[model samples]
Target: MNNDSLSAKPHYPILDGLRGVAAIIVVTFHLTEPLGTGHLDILVNHGYLAVDFFFLLSGFVIGYAYDDRWHNMTIGTFFKRRIERLQPMVVLGMVLGAIGFYFTDSTIWPLIHTIPLWKMLLVLLIGCTILPVPLALDIRGWQEMHPLNSVGWSLFFEYIANILYAIGIRKLSKTALGLLVLIAAVALAHLAITSPAGDVSGGWTLNAEQVRVGITRTMYPFFAGLLLSRTAKPTHIKHAFLGCSFLIASVLYMPRIGGTDHVWMNGVYESVCIIIVFPLIVYLGASGVIHTQAERRICKFLGDISYPLYLVHYPLVYFYVAWISNHQGVTLVQAWPSALLILLGGITLAYASLKWYDEPVRKWLRTKLG
Candidate 1:
């Protein structure tokens, strides 16, 4: 690739909008989770796969942005850039989670009152660093590393992927990277099919098993995404944005394929979606263009709020989940208004944080550190 090609980076507006769409679906998934028994019956059945999709998107974007620029970038410089781009929202998400911590008190976590203020503050501090907390220190009873902001676990893995890329993976030849992706894909399939729950969903805690799940989830799609970036040839496609968005939604909203009796069936389905379908969707999104001014504005708005929406929305979800748990018999029909409020509230907070806080922090970081 020439320097000009490297410098004039193409913005995948549709990909950004797709990311925002996935974030919205995730919030809907969490909102509806309390009404279901398990993954099989959840309202948005495959929303958790959004995290995997995110890993893929991150890898592709990173490769596209940095792989060729390595000659001008040191590992330290790359890490700094990644931190500047990502860490601000992470901190903001944790703070929001802390501010709303007490309000989430409910029957599920009866000990919320028993935990002292100092401990909560300490967890918040640790959470800001994106470090995993042990089970002994799990303050929220969910056993999440960042109990206040459960999504931090994914960010933790994101950092890990970045570190790996900086240290060595970025230097690998295409053949070597392809081999690595294949190995990781096999591991992912095994983890998905063999798990007792028949789904690959155990990466929030600090344990051997969960760590395995986390690693398996992170490795395959990320590397596949890296490979896709290296090999993908974008073609002109009409309405690619709409087409790709529909594809993503369809995959995420599909019902469990095999039901409870054949858990591996759903596992295989999830594996195929992550390993094959998501990459195709990303390719389609990246290849497409926003033809009209309205489309461009829509994509821009969604792209702008995508990260903030993903990071900052979950704290409110904790309260929503707690509220639903407290009211046992309330159907989603009765709770639609509150759910709409939470959705709008999350979008509003995310937009405000983007304009007022996150963008300013990032600009300062870029001025000082760039």
Candidate 2:
């Protein structure tokens, strides 16, 4: 979300557009999740990998945007910029989730109404700071750190990755960074292949195993993207955006591989996508050139709404999931209309948040905090 300048490096519109595409896929993934009996049969089976892709994109952008600015930027200033860019949406997303929390009806979340208002408000206040609450604070019975907005879990890890970069990771020699990334890759692979579900998936909770999952998931792609930004030689690729988008869709939409008997097969697939395929997409996206004004406008629109879409879509999904729980026999086919409405409404709401809330608040924050 950083602005372009007369002297700054040119923006990568394709990367922004790709983020929007992945965010949409994430919405679909959530929409279809409750329909499945378990993770093994979800319709958009591999869609959670989008989180890893986002981590890589974030690392690449951070490296590109701030690596050189250390000479001019203090750590406090770096954090201020990040807070200004990210926290407004965080606060709004939590408030939106809180507003919807009491209305959701689900067998899975029987305690929402029973929880006292003060405790829920306490959770909301901590959520605005993006801190993970303990399981005691889990009012939603989902074990989520921020039960108000479950996706805040990923944002918490994103902040950890950012702090590591600013405090130490950015200072490593390329060889040292490469070595650390190699170690993280091995850890990630081990965790994925040996996981109970064999997909490296559980990170929303604040426990030992889940924290390990979150860290392993964050470290490799993030620093690999950092390494790529430092060492990449971007060559002009024809139709990079279109080609990369197809690659992403294929990876994310691939059906769950390896039945219960051969779980590692799915793990192998996920590891390959995260360790190799996603960085390739980021590199190619960095090399892409927009060919026409139409494509540029499309990219701009997608980029502008991607973050808001991601942060704000899930609270509404909470309601949809509750609906599925209440109406037991509704098939995915019968629910298509509601799913479509959720998709369209999410897009509309994200655009509105970006324009009506995010931009103006950010402008005011920059003036006050800059």
Residue-level lDDT of model 2, residues 1-370, one tens digit each, is 2222214787888998898888899999999998999878999999999999999998888888888899989999989888888899999999999999999947879998799999999999999999999999999999999999988988899899989999999999999999999999999989889898989787899999899899999999888988998999888887888998899999999999999999999999999999999999999999998999898898888888888988999999999999989999789999889998999999999999999999999999999997
| Backbone clash count, each prediction separately | 0, 0
Model 1, 1-370: lDDT tens digits are 0000133887788888888888888888878888887777888888899999989998888888889888888999988888888999999999999999998999888878888999999999999999998888799898888899998899898889889989999999999999999999999999999888788876888999898899899999888988999999988777988998899999988887788789999899989999999999999988897899999888878878889998999999888889988998778898778888999999999999999998899889989997
lDDT assessment of candidate 2? 0.90
lDDT: which candidate is best? 2
Q: What is the lDDT of candidate 1?
A: 0.87
Which stretches of candidate 2 lie above 4 Å from their native place? Answer: 1-7
Q: lDDT of each structure?
A: 0.87, 0.90
lDDT of 2 at 270: 94
